[model samples]
Target: MFNNWSELLPTIQKAFGALGKSNPKMVKAYMALGEAAAENEVLDAKTRELISIAVAITTRCDGCIAAHTDAAIKAGASREEVAATLATAISLNAGAAYIYSLRTLEAYDSLKG
Candidate 1:
C-alpha cells in the first residue's frame, strides 16, 4: 500500500486547504462537484465508493484508492465486497492488457511483413 489511509487523508485535506487558500472559488467548486457526484439517487454511497475504488485502481491513483477505500467502508461495504471489487478491477485490467497485446502483435506482424 502506497499510503496509510488514516494518515494520508488528513495530509491530502491539508494540501487541498492550501490550494483553497490560493484559489478559494475553484476549491469550493471542486468540493461541490464531489458532493453532487456522490448523491445517492441512482447508486448508493457504498456502490459509488466501490466503483470509485475500482476506477482508482485502474487509473493507478493511490490517493483515490485510499480515500475511496475509507469511504466504501464508512458507507457499509463489507470485506467481501471490497475483495470482490478488487477482483473485478484485476480482471478488467488484465482483460485490457490482453486486448492491447493483440494490437501489439498486429503491429509486429506488419513490421515483419
Candidate 2:
C-alpha cells in the first residue's frame, strides 16, 4: 500500500538500525568511508551531500533521506537540486525494476516454449 518512502518510516527505521548493530565494526568502517568522501576537497561538501541524497533515495531509506536532505541543505544544495536528485532516483529505481521484470518475463517465456 505504501507507494513512496514517506509512508515507510517504521520499516526503514527497524532495518536501518539493525544493520548498524549487526556489525558495529563494519558500520564504523563504512562511516569512516563516508567521512573520507565528505572531506575530499575535490568533491566539495555540497556534492558529498548530494551523493548521499541520491543513495538514500535509491535505497528508500527514510532516516537517511531525512539526514542527507538536511546535510544537503546545510551544504548549500538548493531545493531544486534536492528535488532533481530525488527525481533521478525515481528514474533509476524504475529502470532497475523494469530490468528485473523483463528478465522474469523472459524466463517465463522460455518455460512456456
Candidate 3:
C-alpha cells in the first residue's frame, strides 16, 4: 500500500536478483539485450528512458514505470519533459482504443451480414 514510487526500484532490483538466481541464462540474456540497447548511439539515454516510460504506461507495467522514471531523471530529464512524454502516451492509448472500436464495429457489421 506504499505509494512511494522511488522505493519500488530497490524492491524490483531484489526481485530481479532472485529471478536471476533461479534462471541465470535468461536473466543474462535480458541484461545483454539491455546493454546493447543502451549502447545505441543515436537516441541517447534520456530519450530512451522517456520512450521506455511511454511503453511502460501503454503496457501497464508498474515496475517499468518506476525504473524508467528514475532512469529518466538521472539522465537529466525535467518534469516538463516527463509530462510531455506522458501526454504522448495518453494520445496513443486513446488512438489505439479508437482504432479497436472501429475494428469491433466492423466485426459486428460482418457478423450481422
Best by lDDT: 3
lDDT of 1 by residue, 1-113 (tens): 65577898888878879999999999999889878987656888999999999999999987888889999999999999999999999999999999999999999999999
The CA lDDT at 65 in model 3 is 93
* Candidates, ranked, TM-score: 3, 1, 2
Per-model TM against the reference: 0.83, 0.69, 0.92
Give the CA lDDT, 0 to 100, for residue 68 in model 1: 91
lDDT for model 1: 0.91
**lDDT, residue 35, candidate 3:** 90
lDDT of 3 at 61: 94
Residue-level lDDT of model 2, residues 36-58, one tens digit each, is: 87675898888878888888878
The residue-by-residue lDDT of candidate 3 on 7-100, one tens digit each, is 7889999999999999999999999987998886789999999999999999999999999999999999999999999999999999999999
- Candidate 1 vs. true structure, TM-score: 0.83
Better of 2 and 3 by lDDT: 3
lDDT of each: 0.91, 0.81, 0.94
**Runs of candidate 2 exceeding 4 Å displacement:** 1-27, 111-113
lDDT for position 63 in model 2: 75
User: Which of the two candidates, 2 or 3, achieves a greater TM-score against the reference?
Assistant: 3
- Model 2 C-alpha RMSD to native: 4.8
